[model samples]
Target: MYRFLITTSKGLEQLLQQEIQHLLPEIETRNRPGQVVFEAELADAYRLCLWSRLANRVLLQLRSGKGETGDELYDLANKVNWSSHFSADQSFSIDFVGTSRAINNTQFGAMKIKDAIVDHFKDLFDTRPNVEKQFPDLKFHGRLNKEGFGIYLDLSGGSLHQRRYRERAGRAPIKENLAFAVLMRSGWVDAIRNGDESSAEIPVFDPMCGSGTILIEAAQYAAKIAPGLHRHQWGFSHWKGHDIPLWFSLLDEAKVGQITPSMRFLGTDIDAHVIEIAKDNANIADVGDFIQFEVADATQQPNTFEKAGYIVSNVPYGERLGELTELLPMFKSWGGHLKQAFPEWHLSLLTSDRDMLRQLRLMAGKEYQFINGNIECQLVNFHLDEKNCHIADKEQDNHSDFANRLRKNISKLKKWLKTANTDCYRVYDADLPEYNVAIDVYGDWVVVQEYAAPKNIPKHKTISRLQDILIAIPDIMQIEPSQLVLKTRQVQKGKAQYQKLDKSSDELIVHENGAKFAVNLHDYLDTGLFLDHRDVRQKVRQMSKDKRVLNLFAYTGSVSVFAALGGAKSVTTVDMSNTYLNWAKRNLALNGIKGAYQYPLVRKDCLTWIRECEQQFDLIFVDPPSFSNSKNMQGSWDVQRDHAGFLRLVRMRLAPGGTIIFSNNLRQFKLDPDLQDSLGLRITDISAESIPFDFKRNQKIHHCWVMQDDA
Candidate 1:
C-alpha cells in the first residue's frame, strides 16, 4: 500500500477526511490540522485525487526520518534511489515547507534536498534532472517539523482548487473546493442526492453571484460531474512508476461517472459585466445549459423558483470603511427581501466580517467558520421561516433619539428644500452631539462625515455609536447602505487635504438650482461639491451677469460653472490641482458650457497668481482654504494670519465698480478689522445671507463677505 497525505484548508480537515473515506472506503484514514493521512495503493491515490473535492493536493509519501540539520536532511534524502522515481532527463521542482534548526530558510532546505537528489542521480548515471519551476515533470514536497522530515511526490500537480474553469473572476472570488465544502455544510449535496433528477425538487440560487463560483460549483456537484474530470494533466503523468493504464482507467471512470442530472440553478449579479464573466465560466465548466445567469439587483430581485429550496451566496463584505458603510444597508435590504420573497427556503451566506452579519437581522440558525486563502470567514445559515425572520426595522434599537432627531430634521427641511429647488442638502449635522456626524445627501447618495470622537470617549464606545448612526441613516433617509459613503473628518494640514483617500472615482452628477456638478463621494475626504456653499454659488451667478468673472481657488469649478450659466461675458478659473481643474471642465461640459476663450482654466497656485495677475475682473470670488501648504505653493498660508495681505492683492485685481465675494471656513477667522480703512475697501459681511437654511444650525460652516473697491 502507498502512504499518502492530503492537504486542504485549515478548518476543513475533518470534512476532507470524510470525503476521502467515502471515495476510498478501504483506506485507513487519519485527520490532522490542514491535512489527512492515509495508506492506499497508487491507483487509490489517483482515485482520491479525481474525487476529493475538498482536498487541495494529494501527495504520495516516499520517505520520512529524523533530520535535525541540513547535512542530516541531505543524508536522509540521499538514501532514496533517485533513478526509481524518474529518469535523470525529467525536470523536477521542490516545494519546501516548515523550518529546521540548521535550515531555517525554506530555500536553504530545498537547496540541501535538491543537492542530495542531484548527487544520487549523478552517482547512478553521471547525469541529473533539470530544475523546472513552472511546469515540472515531477514535483516534490518537502516538510520538516520538530518530530522529523518527510518528502512527498505531489500527485495532483497543482492545487485542486484551481479547477481551470474560471478564467475570469470578480472581487474576492471563493475557491472551488471551499465553495464545495460550503455546499456540503449547507446540506445541499445531500438534498441533490435524495431528489430525483427528472423532477429536481431543489433549486439553488445565488443573488450576488460574482463570476458564479458557488453556483457553478453547486451545478457541477448536482450533475454528478467529477471536480477533476476536465484536468488533462497530473503530477504522476511523467513519474517513472506511474501506471498510465490505471490512471487512464480512473479518468475514463470519472468521465463515465458524470450523469446528466436535471438541475434547477440560477445565478444573478447587479453588475452586467460580471454576469457575462459568470456565463463564460459556466460554459467552460460545461454547465451553462444547466444554469441561468442574469443581471439583477439583489435588493429588488424576488424568488423565481416555483418551490423553495436554498439561497446561497458569498455576500460582499466591503473591505474599506466607505464600502462597509454602503453595504450595511444593502445587507439589511437583502435580508428583508429574502424574508418576504423566499420564506421557508434555506439561506447560507459567507462573509469575512462578523459585524456585517448583524445587518441581516435574521437569526442565523447555524454558523460555521472557514478559511478562504488567509482570511478567516464565517458561513452563516438561516432558515427563512416566520419564527426566524425578524424583518422589522431595527433603526430604533438603542439610537431612537438620534433617529427621531433625524426624522425631525428631514421633516423641517422638506418645505425649505422644495422652495430652494435643491435635491442635495444636509439632512443632519451633529443634531445630537453624541452622534457627532454630518450627514449630507447628493441626489440618491448620502455621505456621512464623522468628526473624530473626543479623546476621553472609549474607542469601543465610539465604534458602537458610529454603528448605531450607520444603521439609523439608511432607513430614515429612505436610501440603501450602498448609496452611503463614510469618511472621518479631521483637521488637515499641508497637502494632506488634497491627497486621495480612495481611487474609486465614483463620480455622480448632482443638480442645484438647475446647474449640474459632478461630485465624487468615494475618492476624497471631501466631496467635490460643497453643500454649505450652495447659496454662495447662486450669489456668484446673480453677480456675474454681463461681467468678467474670476474664481480664485476654484475647487471643482462649481462657482465658475454657475457664473458661465449666469451669462458671464468671460470667466477665469484658477487652481493648482489638475484633477480639480479637469473636474471643473467636466462640470462646465455637463451644463453645455465650453470654450477656453470664454471660460479659461488656469493651473497655478492662487496665492502666487494673485500677485502676478494684471487682468481686472468685474466680479471676483476668492474662497481660499483655511490653511494651505501645498508643495506647488511657495510658502505656508493660514487664512487667519494671511487674509490681510491676500485681500490687498485681490483688491488690486478688482476693476471699477467691481464686487469681490470673499469667503473662508476658518471658525476663528477675524478678517483684519482695520483692512477696510487700510486698503480703501468697503467690506460687507454676508456670512448670514450666504448661510443656506440647511446650514443654519452650524452657522459658522463658513464666513462670507462681499467686498467692493471704494474710490
Candidate 2:
C-alpha cells in the first residue's frame, strides 16, 4: 500500500477525513490541520480522485527524511530511484512549501531538489529532464521544515478545486471543493447519504447562485457525477509507473455509475449575465438537466417547489460599511419573503457579516466557520417553522433576563406612550447592569447603543451577552430586525463622535409634540434627535414665542425647527458640519419652515462664530459636544473647561431678557460653579425637569440648565 496525503482548506479537516473514510474505509487514516494522511492502494487513490468532493489535492508520498541543511535535502532526494517515478525524457515541476533555517526560500529549496534529480539522471543516462512551470508532464511537491522534509508526487495536476467546468466566473466565486464543504456543513449531503428512498428525494435550491458553484455541486452529488470527470489532464498522466489501463477502468466505472437524480435543483441570481454563465457551467458539468437556472431577484422570488426541502446559498454580505446599509433592506425583505413563501424549508446561508444574519430574523440552530477563498465566513443553519419563523424571545439564561427587563419597561410605557404626543421614546436604559446597553424607539425603528463593557469582564462573555440582547430586543420592541440598529458607544474624543458611521444618506421623519423633524439612524452614532431631551426641546418651544432664536452647535436643528414653529421672529442655526447643516435645512423644509431670511444656516465652528458674531437674539441655545477638536476650529472646546468663557462670549450676543438653554450628555458633567458671577448671569439648573419620563431610569442621560442675564 502507498502512503497518500490529502489537502483541504482550514476548518474542513474533519469533513475531509469523514469523506475519505467513507470512500476508502479500509485505509488507515489520520488528520492534520489542513490535510489528511492515509495508507491505501493505488486504485484507492484513483477512486478518491474521482469521488472525494471535499479534497483539494491528492498526493502520493515518494520519500521522507531529515533535511536540516541544503546538502541534506539534495542527498535525501538523490537517494530515491528517479527513473522509477518519471523518465528523463519528460518535464517536471516542484511545488515546494515550508522552509527551514538553512533553506529559508522556497524557490532555492526547490532548485536544490531539481538539481539533485537532474544530476542523478545525468550520471546514469547522460541526459536530464526539463523543468516545466506550467502544464508539466509530472509535478512533485516538496515540503521542508525543522522536523525534516517529505517529497510527494502530486497526482492531481493542480488543486482539485479547479473542476475545469468553469470557463468563466463571477466576482468572488467560491471554489468547487469549498462549496462541497459548505454542503456538508449544511447537512444536505448527509441527508442523501443516510436517508431512506423518500428522504433522498428532497430538492435543493440556491437563491444567490453566483456562477452556480453551489447548485452545480449539489447537482453533481445528487446525479452521482464524479467531481474530477471533466478534467482533461493530471500529474500522473505522464508518470513512468502510471497504468493508463487501470485509470481508464476506473473512469469507465465512474461514467457507468452515474444515474439520473430523482429531484430537480433550482438556482436563481439577480444578474442575468451571471445566470447565463451558471447555465453554461452547469452544461459543462453534465448536470444541466438536473438544475434550472433563472434570472430573478432573491428578495422577490416565488417558491415553486411542491414540498419543503433545503435552501442553501452564499448570501451577499457587504464587506464595507456603505454596502452594509444598502444590503440591510434586501436581506430583511428576502427574509420576510422566505417566511411567507417557504414556511417549512430549511435555510442555510453563508456570510462574512454576522449582522446580516440578525437581519434575517431567523434563529440559527447551528453555525460553522470556514475560510472561503481568503475570507473567514459563517455558515448559519436555520429550520423554518411557524413557532420560530419570526424574531422571538430566546429563553437562554443570558437572554431571558435582558428580554424580561425590556418587556417590563415596555409594559410600563405602553400607557404613557399613547399619550406622550411623540412616538419616539426610551424603552430600556441598562436596567440590568450586566446588559449594559440603552434602547431608544424612534417611531418604527429601535436604536441600541452598547456601552463599552468593563475591562474586568471577559470579551467573549460581553460578546455573548450583546448577541443575546440583539436577539431579544426585536421581539420585545415589536419591530422587525430591519428596524433595529446597533452601534458601539464608547468615550469618543475630538470630532470622532461626529464622524459618519455609514454613508447610507437615509433619512426618516418622526414627529415630536406638534413639530416634525428628520432623523438619520444609520449614518451617525447619535441619531439627529436625542430622545432624552424631549422635555428640554418642548421647554424651548414653549418659551420661544415672538422671540428671536439662535441655536449654537445645532445638530440637524431639531430645536431650531421647534423654535421656528413656535412663531419666533427669525431663527439662526450655527454648526461646523455642512452635512448637519444641510440636514437641518431638510428638517426645516420638512416642517414647512423655509427661507434663508427666516432661518439662516451658518457653517462655522460655534466657538469661532460666537466670537465674530455682531447680531444679538432674544433667545440662545447651546448644546455643544462634550469635547471637540474638529479641524474646522482653531482649537478644541471642552464643556467643563471652556463653558465659563464660552458662555461669557454668548452673553455678549444675548439681547436683554434673553435666555440660553445649555445642555450636554456628559455623564460626569458639572456646571462651572463660578459661571453665575463669571458670565454675570443667573443659571438655574433644570436638569431634573429636562429628562423625559421614559428616561428616568438614567437620570444622567443629559444635564440641562436655563441661563439668563443677572439683571
Candidate 3:
C-alpha cells in the first residue's frame, strides 16, 4: 500500500479532505494545515490528481516530513529507491515549499534533494540521471515547516486550486477558497445537508452572492462529489506505482454515492447582469436545481423568505463602494423592518467597516470577527425574538450609536489608507446630494475607499448636494475623482468610464487574470494589477537573472519586469499588438528600468515569432489569452486546442537547461499526447496551482510544463 497526500492551502483543507475521504472511504485519512494524508494504491494517486479541486499537489508521502536540516532532507530523499521511481536516463524536478529554519531558500533546498536523487541513480546505475526543470516525468515535493518536511513525488504535477469554472469576473471579487471558507464558517454545509442549522430551523442564503461561489461550493460539498471527479487526471496514474483498476474502483465508488439533493439553498444579488452570471455558473456547476438566484436587494427579500433562514452578505463598505450615508439609514430602517417583517430569521452581515456593524442592530447573537482576504470584516449574527420588537424602541439610541461607530471607522480608514499608500479611484454618489465618500489615491491604485458620513441637516435633496458639494470640492481642488461603477440594484450601474470633470490621466493595464491595473489616478473600472500573482513574479525573479528570458504573448510585461529586476542577461517579450508592446516598455520604464537588458519588445505574432526566432531562452513565461486573434495570428486561439502547438514552439526555443512556466485560464486542459508521442518532449499539467489564492475560483485557471531532454 502507498500513502498519497492531497495538499491544499489553509482554510479549505477540511472541505478537500472530506471530499477525498468520501471518494476513498477505506483509506486512512489524516488532515493537517496544508495536506490530507491517506493510505491508498498508486492508482488512487492518479485518480486524485486528475479530479481533486482543492489539493495544491497530490504527493506520494515517501517520508513523513520528520527531517530537520537540509542535509537530513537530502538523506531522506536519497533513501527513496531512485531506480524504483525514475530510470537513470530519465529526469526530475523538486519543488520546495513551506520550509522552516532548516531549509531557508526553497530553491537551494529543492536542489539538494535533486542532487541526492541524481547521486543515488549514479551510485547504482554507474551513470547520472538528468535534472529537468521544465517538465520532469516525476516531481519531488519538499513541504517543510516548524514540524519537518514531507518528501514526496508531486503526483498531480500541478496544484489543484484551479477548478476552471468561472468564465468572467468583477473587480475585487472574493476568491473560491475564501468563499468556501466563508460558507464553511457560516455552517452552510451542515445546514444544507441537514436541511437546517443546529441553532436555527431556517435556510442558509447569500443575499449578495456575487459570483455564485458560495452556492456552488455548498452544492458541491453537500453532494459527495470529488471536486476533481469532473477534471481529467488523477496524478497517481502518472507514477509507475499507480494501479489503474484501483483508481477506477475508487471512481466507481464515488459515482455510486452521487445523489440529487433536495434543499432550499438560494442566492440573490441586486445586479441583473450578475444574476445572469450566477445562472450561467449554476448551469456549469450542474446544480441549477439545487440553487435559485434573482435580482433582489439583501434587505428587500428577507421578508419573502417565509421560513427563518440565515441572511449572509458581503455588503458595500469603502469609498469605491460608494457613499453609505444613504445606505446607513437604509440599514437602520431595514433592520427595524426586519424585526417587523421576519421576526425569526437570523441576519448575519459581513462588512469591512465597523460602522456597518453598528448600523445593523443585530442584538441577539455574538459576532464572528475574522479577516476576509485583506479586508477586515465582522460577521454580525442575530437570532430573532418576538419580544425584541419594543427592544427595537432603543431605535433612537441606536441612531446615536451608529453615529459614534461611524466616526471611529471613518477615522480608522482615513489613517489606514494614508499608511498603506494607496490611491482612490472610487468616489461613490458623486452625483448624489448629501453623500460624502472622499477617497485618496496612492501607488496609482484604489487601495482605500474612505467612508465619511455627510453632515445631517434639513437641506436640499441628497443627490443635488452630492453633485454641488462633494463633486465640486474635488473639481475645485483640481482632483479628478471617478464616480464609483459598482454593481448595485439601484437604477443603473453607470457607464464604464472615468466620470471626472476633466479628462484624467490614468494608465490602465488589463491583466490576464482579468484585473484592471492602472498607473495613474484617472477614470477606469479598475487599475489593472494582479497583486496576487506576486509569487509568480517572485519565481521569475529567481529564474531570470543573467539569463535570456522570453515572455510569450506578454501582456504589459509583468513577468518581463520581474525578470529584468532579477538581473536577466537579456529579455525578449512577444505579443501580436504593437500597442501593448509599447505599454510594456512604458511599464518597465515606469519602474526606473531601461536598456537592452530586455531587447526589442516585439510586435510580431507569437506563433510566427516562435517559428522565426533562431535564439534559445534560459527562462520563458507563457500566459496566453483564453481566446484571441490578430492578422498575423488569425483565427481562434483556444489554450486547450492550441496548447500543443504553443508547447512545440516553447520546446523548440527553450535552452537545454531552461524552464518555461506556461499558464492559461482554460479550466480544462488535456495534454496533446501526440506532441509527447510524436515530438518526444515531456509535458505535465501544472495549471491547477497556477491560480493564486486571491485569483482562485475552482477551475478558473490551468497550468502545464514543457521540457526537452537528451540522452
Candidate 4:
C-alpha cells in the first residue's frame, strides 16, 4: 500500500478523515489540523483525486528523512532519483511549505530543492529539466519542520479545490472545497447522496448564492459526480510512475457511476449579474440541468415548496461599522421572513459575525468552526421546528417594554396634541436606551427612525431590539404594517441628506396645525414635512402677516406655504433641486395658494441667487442643510464653516430692521462671535421657544436663531 497525504483547510481535518474512512474503510488514517495521512494503493489514490471534495491536494509521499541545513535537505532530495519521476525535457515546479532554521526563506529553500533535482538530471543526462512555475508537467512539494523535512510529489497538482467548473466568481466567493465542507457539515451530502429514497428527493437551496458555488457543489455531490472528472491536467498525468490505462479506466468508471437522482437544487441572488455568472458556472460543471438559478431577493423568497428541504446561504457579514449598522435590521427581517415562510425547512448559514447569525433569532442545533481565508467563521445549522420558530421570551419582554414606553410618551403628549389641534406629533423619541428609535405620528401613519447604535453594541442585540420596536409600534398604535415606515438615521456626509433612498414617487397630503402639506414617506430619506418644525412653522405664519417673505434654501417650501397662508404680501422660495421646487409649488397648491405671483418658486443655487438679488424682504428664513455638496451647488457648504459668509449674503438682501430666521439640524452648531460683532446684528437663541412639546426629550434636535440688524 502507498502512503498518501490529503491537505484541506485547517478546521476540516476531522471531516476529511471521516470522509476518507467511509470511502476506504480498511485504510489506516491519521488526522491533523490541515492534513490527513492514510495508507492506500494506487487505485485509492486515483479515487481520492477524482472524488474527494474537501481535500485541497492529494500528495504521494515519495520519501522522508531528517536534515538540519539547506545542503543536508538538498542531499535528502537528491537521493530520490529525480530523473525517474520526470524526463529531462519535462518542465517542473517546486512548492515548499513550513520553515526550518536553515530554510528561513521559502524561495531560497525551493531553490535548494530545484538545484538538487537539476544536478541529478544533469548528472544522468547532459541536459536538465526546465522550470515551469505556471503550468508544470511535474510538481514537487516539500515540508520543513523543526525535526527535519519530507518531500512528496503533488499528485493532484494545482490544488484540487480549483474545480474546473467555475469560469467566473463573485466577490469573496467561497472556495469550492470549503463550500463542500459546509454542505457536509449540514448533513446535505448524506441526505442527497446516500440517504434513503425519500431523503434523496429533498430539495436544496441557497438564497444568497454568490456565483452559485454552494449550489454547484451540492448538485455535483447529489449526482455522485466526481469532483475532478472535468479537469484537463493533473500532476500524475506527466509523472513517470503514473498508470495511464488504470487512470483512464477509473475516469470511465466515475463517468458511468454518476447517479441521475430526482432532486431539485435552486440558487437565487438579488444581483442579476451574479445570477447570470452562477448560471454560467453551473453550465460549465455540466450540472445546469440539475440546478435552477434566478435573480431573487432573499427577503422575498416564496414558500412554494411542497416539501421540506435545506436552505443554505452565506449571508453578507458586514466588515465595517457602517455596513454592520445597515445589515442589522436586514438580518432581523430575513429571519422573520424565513420563520413565517419556511417553518419546516432546515438552515445552514456561514458567517464571520456570530452576532449577525443570532439576529435570525433561531437557535442553531450545531455550529462548525472553519477558517474562511483569515476570518474565523462558523457554519451554524438550525432545524426550524415550532418551538424555535417564534420570537424568544426575552424578545417578547423587550417588545412589551417598548410598547409601555410608547404608551407613556403618547399619554404625556395628549394635552399638547389637543391644545395644538394637530393629529401628527412625536409619540416616542428614544424613551429607552435599548430601543433607540424615534416614533412620529402623521395622522394614521407612523414613521420609525432608528438612530445608529453605538459601535460597541452587538449588532444582534440592536436588531432584536429593532424587531421588538417594529412589532410594538403597530400593536401599541393599532395601525397596519403598511402605515409604519422604518428608516435608519446615521451621520450623513455631503449631499447624502438630499439623496433619494428609494425610487417610489409616492406623496401623501398630511395636516399640520390646520394646514395641508404634501409628504412623501417612501421616496426620500426624510419625509417632506418636518414634524419637529410644526411650532416653528406656526411662528413663521404669525410673524409673516403683510410682510414680503424670502425663504432661502427652501426645501419643499413648507415655510413658504405657511407664510403665504398667513397673508404675506409676497413669498419667494429659493432652492437648488427642481424636484423640490416642483414639490414646493405642489405644496402651495395643496394649501389653496396658487398663481406664480402669490408664491414664486425659484430653482437656483441659493448662495448665487442671494448674491445677485436686489429685492428687500421684511422676513427671511434660511435653513441650509447641515452640510451639502450637491453637483448643482457652486462648492461644498458647511453650516459651521460657511455660516458667516452665508449669513452676510442674507443680511445684504434684508431690509433695515427686518428679521433673519436661521435654523439648522447640526446639533453642535456654534454661531461665529465675529459675525455678530462685525455685522452689528442682535441675535437671540430661540431654540427653546421653537421646540414643540412633543420634542421636549431631545431639545437639540435643531438649533434656531433670530437675527436683526442693530440699526
User: lDDT of all the models against the reference?
Assistant: 0.87, 0.86, 0.61, 0.85
Give the range where candidate 2 is weakest over 10 consecutive residues by summed lDDT: 390-399
List, residue by residue over 432-513, the lDDT tens digit for candidate 4.
Answer: 8888999888778888888999999998789767766765666678876667777888988767877887666777778877
Write out the backbone clash pairs for model 4.
Answer: none
Cand. 4 TM to true fold: 0.65
User: What is candidate 3's local distance difference test score?
Assistant: 0.61
Give candidate 2's root-mean-square deviation (CA, Å).
Answer: 6.9
Estimate the TM-score of every prediction. Answer: 0.77, 0.70, 0.51, 0.65
Model 1, 505-559: lDDT tens digits are 8888888999888889888998998889999999999888899999999989999
TM-score comparison, 2 vs 3, better candidate: 2
**Top candidate by lDDT:** 1
lDDT of 2: 0.86
TM-score comparison, 1 vs 2, better candidate: 1
CA shift of 566, model 1, Å: 8.6
